[model samples]
Target: MRPRSLDEFAGQEHVVGEGSVLRRALDAGEVPSLILWGPPGSGKTTLAQLLSAQVGAAFEPVSATSAGVADLRRAVERARVRSRSSDTRTVLFIDEIHRFNKTQQDAVLPQVENGVVTLIGATTENPSFEVNSALLSRSRVVRLEALGDMQISALLDRALADTDRGLGSRAVELEDAARRRLIELSGGDARVALNALELAVMATSDTNGSARVGPEDIEGALQQPALLYDRAGDQHYWLISAFIKSVRDSDPDAAVYWLARMLEAGEDPMFVARRMVILAAEDVGIADPQALAVAVAAQQAAHFVGMPEGYLPLTEAALYLAVAPKSNSALRAYAAARADVAATLNQPVPLHLRNAVTSMERAMQFGAGYRYAHDQEGGLIEQQHLPDGLTGRRYYEPTDHGAEAAIADRLRAMRGVSPRVSYRDTPRPMIGSKRPRGQAFGDRTLHFEPHVPLIGGRRPNTSRSCGAGSPIPR
Candidate 1:
């Protein structure tokens, strides 16, 4: 049953409660052109009707999904005629107002501006994004929230007891368990709860002239819970946001719960997979380097397998990311470097770090004093790799978590700073380096000796050449 007055309204106390702005305005017979924004079954249409009744105004209703510019003009003409002939105010209620296009919404703008009809636009979307700015600016937007369990229960009770508008005259009894199940399935939508309750009562066989609706009856009436999700609406962004935040907060349970909610509600699995990939890089960076690989693999697996089975890999990746060691050092390092790039003048690369590809370039000393790390002891040499303007600047600050702890120690030693522990004992082979079997740098022997040539069946020269013959610096 729809609320006939503000007093009968079960939820949204903040909007129309005693001493509230809309309540006071209605009491004063001043109904402003309004935008009622909220989730479905939140009493938007009922509130509009009540507002018109309170002010003794004629109510004219239209559905934006079906109404066009012609329908709007006709309604405005009727209101204009009524206003002149009988001085009666008309409340033009447009349900699903966000469905109207720019042209259709624009047609109502002049009518509202000139006070031909007091427009009451009801939308299940954020009016700011869906409604045209001109119309939104002219209307006082009032946000309605979903009804809570207590509010829904109160409404259900009213329906069962009120003989005039509800099912009270049918001698129907609703079991407590059935009521709870109905409320849960409704997802805080009062209209769904009331309709399902009515169905349950009607479907139950009479027991001695009175029908008793139990949990089974309620479940049968509502075959499955309708999830309150709109893929192109606020729910889409909100669910994904919650899922990412839960993973970032390292709550595996919450992460998986939100993941299941999205998948069950028909969200694009690819969309969820993409966001997870981003989260793995942004939130679970170098602290556990494998996190990025896992997220990417999950995305590929989900795409390859397609949904139903795709959710398996998605769930696995969500758990992996949630429990993995986290570090934002990579994100912060890039941000710090970006700030320098923006703040400083465009600086030239150091001459030694540049490639001397041409003879003229070699004469200009492009590769003047660049040291070859392969020839140096420990394959590490003290060098100025940064530009002259950024001689001592540091970007990457590895954290002491998971595999990054070892990296941080190695970096400290590379920078000639005393590390918390020795890292030289575990020297690994440099990437793409193929040293001869007996070659040694200082006392550390090369553990990885390739049997075949590294590139094109020719042994790569491992010398201190810095001119044209040397490989270009990565």
Candidate 2:
């Protein structure tokens, strides 16, 4: 049953609750051209109708799927005539407004500008991307949230008791279990809940002048729950973000749960695999160096085997990453280096560090004082490898986690710096103890940088090769 008035409307208290902006506007008979953006069955159409009636405006409804420019022009003409003759406003309600192309949307802009019709456009897509700038600027977008369980329950109760508009005439009695299951299956859509409830009552056998709806009846009526997901819409981004964050937080359970959600919802398995691959490098890093290999193997396995069997490797990779020691040192090192590259002017490699491929270059002492590590004791010697301007800058800071611990110790030894005590050797931090800020290496503080998506295919201008005399092409 549709809500006839704002009072009867459930949920979206932020939009039309008492003392709210839209509520005040509607009460003052000053309804503006609006864009209602939300999921299906969230009462976009019903709210538009109620708003039109509240202002005593002539309602002209059109579906973007079936209505074209001609239909829109006719509606505008009707609004013009009505406004001139009877001094009545017109509310042109377009459902699925995102379906309208730029040309079709443009056709209505002039009418809206002149106030021939107060447009109320509804869309399941984000208006920022789908709606054109001119029309979007003119209309105020009101976002409606999905109905919560309590709100949906209230709507069901109202439907069962109202004989005039709901299924109250049938005298249907819904079992508590059936009601809960129906609400769960509806996915916060009041229209779906009401329709399924009506179907369940109609299908169930009448007993003692009343049809009793059980869990089975409700399940049968619904058949399958329609997941609130659009592959190319917000759901895609939201689910993937949840999955990545869960893995980064080292919550294996949450990671797997999100993975299953995405996979079962028909998200491209390859996309999930690719993101996992990036996560292995960006989150797991050298803490568990094998994490990258596992992620890569999973990607290959998924591509080779294909679903539904492909989920096997995908699940294994997700678990491995979630449990692996976490480190963003690799990510941080790259970011530090990248920032320097972006900020500083191109600095040439030192003459000693450059290759002298030609006789003429050798005569100029290009390879003059470079100490080859292979000729030095222990294959390590103190030498300036970086350009003169950046002779002592350290970029790669190895964390004391997993395999990186040994690397950190080696690096300290090479740099003539004493290694700090290992964190694993010490007693673990007590539960609820304040975690040390950033990457902890005993008493030393190494700031951990947050993960940032890498922009691929960018190279520094001063990059050079050891085997060639020329600078590497950018």
Question: After TM-score superposition, what is the CA distance of residue 55 in candidate 1 from its true location, in Å?
Answer: 1.3
Instruction: Compute the lDDT of residue 292 as modeled in candidate 2.
Output: 99
**Candidate 1: C-alpha lDDT:** 0.82
lDDT of 1 by residue, 1-474 (tens): 887778999889999999999899988989999999999999999999999999999999999989899999899899999999999999999999999999999999888888899999999988888999999899999999999999999998899888899877877878889888888888889989998988888788575546899999989998987787899988898999999999999999999999999999999999999999999999999989999999999999999999799999999999999999988888777765665565444668999999999999999999999999898644556677767655566567677987787676555434432122111122322323432122211243222221211233233476432332223221
TM-score of each: 0.86, 0.86
Model 2, TM vs. native: 0.86
- How far residue 85's Cα lies from its native spot in candidate 1, in Å, is 1.2
User: What residue pairs are clashing in model 2?
Assistant: none
Cα error, candidate 2, residue 187 (Å): 1.2
lDDT of 2 by residue, 14-59 (tens): 9999999999998898999999999999999999999999999999
